[model samples]
Target: MISCVFLATCFVAIVADAHEAHEPVVVVDSDAMRQAVLAWRSTLGPELTRQASFEFAGPVRTDWHFVPKDRLGVNWHDMNLEQRRAAHNLLRIALSSQGYFKALAIMSLDEDLRRLEASRPNAQNVRDPERYWFALFGDPSSDEPWGWRIEGHHLSLNFSSVTGQVVSVTPAFFGTNPAELRDGPRAGLRVLGTEEDLARDLITSCTPAQLKTAMIAETAPGDVIALPGVEINFGEPEGLSAEEMTDAQQALLRNLLDEIIGNFNAELRERALDELEDAGFDKLHFAWAGSVEVGKGHYFRIHGPTLVIEYDNTQNNANHAHLVWHSPDNNFGADYLQRHYAESPHHQSAK
Candidate 1:
């Protein structure tokens, strides 16, 4: 009897290990990843690309403003396997776009990786790790869900995952201090022209009444209201919704939203769109702040049932730029949690 019991225990342990091994892992296609990287590389000139690779690989510690270097951002802890994979690819493509200044952004991330790694040598915290650190959380060998974070000065991309799906991809913050270089070796460089122009066009297109509804405040908020540790509340939608606009105006709104949302690929973009569609056009709002003039400090926000986007270009004589895309229900994989917990044993007992 004792021998039989021991054998049974061994079999259970083996089965558990096998189950864990079979759990889905976030696997990215190397070819897809390479294509994204190359696309961004092509945007930057060859000389800048070579320099960017070098700078990104070098040892340097960038500043950490509001959050601790080791602490993960809020929403990164809840994504599932597939969502995490999509988030990783989305961020890689966004950061590696073509253009000398855009290339610098990638290089800066690389440097941050080296700095983090050097500080934790045994941990191998290089750019690849730093850029996608959030994907490594939880048991790499277990079937249990886990979370990860990607953070550094001027960049924070956080996503959470469960079994194998993404739950949240915000509060994502992307900013550039010098939006354009007025003087330097790379003189007259603008890192985020498309981002800046889209917002401006949207605001300028608004009618007097539309502008009245959209302009939430006269002054820029200085910085993003939600930082690393703050609990964010979805403020009530304040601007005009798509339903209020004519077809031409609606198209303009979509064009601006797409410019921002399209940073993600087809699948993720569709997911965002589905959520937006369910919210309906009447629930959307747009709000603006700061200067009305181009090339000056300014900001705008678009709010709806499932989406919140903020853009500010008020620093460095409207040269600094910051933007964020967030979803309330989807923040940090909250949707995944609902689905997961509902099926969990604990949930069944509570019910």
Candidate 2:
């Protein structure tokens, strides 16, 4: 009997391993990916760029920033199957193309990653070839669902996808130190050229009357007003609505907005565009701050029903750039959360 029991256990272990090995890998459609890549590249225009490639093997081998194993707020083991899948998908997206761009943005910095790793050994270690250390607390196993953070300097993205839905994508940040350079081997490099030029041109093109409404304040804020952890309160819609603009002006605004928000994948970009359309162009508020002169510290913000874009050209004598797009209602697919909760045991049991 003892021999039989031991043999049965071994069989079960082998089967489990086989099942894991055969799990379907997430395969992004190449054509779809190509289109998205092209759209983003077109926005970049001609710029000095480099390519880096990586292949991840599950969470175990994924590059993640390290944090104290005890402080990880997620309990992955407690999440159901669907929850686990969603969490994995979110992490995959975070680490794939978007994550790659973040790394590339800072790759130019001399010893930036090395210094961060040394100063914060626990917080900055890269665990696997594809995974960097950026968490503090429990491991990201299927056993427990826990909050996890993946950050490295200019790139800081946090996610808490539990029970088959993403909780948040806040503190999602992207910044380029050298927005544009006048000298270097890659001289006249402008990483985010379209993002800057389009908006500037739109504002400059506005009639004096339009500028009166678009430029809410003459002063530029020292930093982005909507910092992390703050409740997103969009002030009243305050700009000349698209309906009010001349056809040419309207076209420019649309093109500029497209260039700004097209940084995401196709699906997300479509959703954002739809939201913008539904909100109506008249509802948007465009506010500017600081000097209007190029190469000077300046900032602009666009707020509408489904979009909020903040651009700051303040660092390095207005050469450094920061831009962000946020949707108050749909960030991290808040709509998906309602569906997930409806099926959750916690909600079902309460009902």
Candidate 3:
């Protein structure tokens, strides 16, 4: 279990000016992220900085994945104790406690994989908690827009800031192999259990007619429909929209969406929720594929005009899982950056 005490210490609240005396505001500070990133870069020194820093406009900023491969930035294995602390501080600033702990738990799953696949000669090499990489694009301290990413085998979090405010937090992907650990000390541990159970709850609650409309396929796909690098266009959502759901079912859907959005800091979560509301919550669709049972191959997605959230658990006999959140126009602050550059001619040259 993650220590709440440690989380509190690591992520001390930054209070913004209050609108009223009794209503002091507190939010996840983007300026704090900038400071933390700057500290992390300084700790990395000259040599490692070269490896971790990239031009914000280049393909490198968008070249992201949740696969084990030769990735950009400095890997955890190479960071010293102090440098690692700086990196973690940056994470604490960017992610909510729920999000940060989930990331750590996800990384620890590599050990479980290493033990389960011990027979494979390369398993030990590939499954390592220290394989996560942290990279920065452009200068976080400057007025120009910039971003950062922390990515590894089963996790990828991309954050973008413009003028000291987080403008985008999309393409946030989290996955787990052996979704439920069946043996050993952490037996029955499901890092992404909520993501699975919530969808199951909603789908299982459907009436026969609703199920008929919601089920998109008899078999689950091998993976999520939207993989990295693929242009995300589902055209029209292919399942039951919120408008078709009962009030009780809509409440369940909102709870599920909360679980997903709660992974980000409070400010980002509120912004995201507001975006969903503005996009017409009634337009959001919930689609399911495969068996609606535990330990079975299954997949589900909630997609609408502005947002897309996908979950899949079909590989390794339904033990592997993938969950992702994306936005069509605002991914990596694409739309925000466009407006920013258009308004500031100097930034256009910087890009």
- TM-score winner: 3
Candidate 1 lDDT trough over 10 residues, lowest sum: 54-63
Global lDDT scores for all candidate models: 0.53, 0.50, 0.85
**Model 1 regions lying over 4 Å from their true place:** 1-135, 140-142, 346-351
Pairs that clash in candidate 3: none
RMSD of every prediction: 16.8, 15.6, 5.0
Per-residue lDDT over 125-210 for candidate 1, one digit per residue giving the tens place of the 0 to 100 score: 33332332222333212334433345554555544545544445566666665566555344454545676776677778888988
- Number of the top candidate by lDDT? 3
* Backbone clash pairs in model 1 (N, Cα, C under 3 Å; residues 3+ apart or in different chains), count: 23
Stretches of candidate 3 exceeding 4 Å from the true structure: 1-26
Candidate 2 per-residue C-alpha lDDT over 1-351 given as tens digits, one digit per residue, 9 for 90 to 100: 112123223443554675678854243442332233223223322321111111111232123222213222223332334533443344434443333333343333313333424565553433211222233212232322223454443444544343422344433555555677565444464656676787778788889898887776677776666555555686776666666677787787888777655444334345557767877876676667777888888888878877777888887778777766566664443444456556663642211
TM-score for each of the candidates: 0.63, 0.59, 0.91
lDDT of 3 by residue, 1-351 (tens): 233223332332321122224563259654777788899999998989999989888898898899977698999887888998888888867777667777877888888788999998898889877788998988887887888999999899998887678889889999988799899877887878988998999999999999999999999999998899999889989999999999999999999999899888778899999989998999999999999988899999999878899999999999999999999899999888888888886787443
Best-to-worst lDDT order = 3, 1, 2
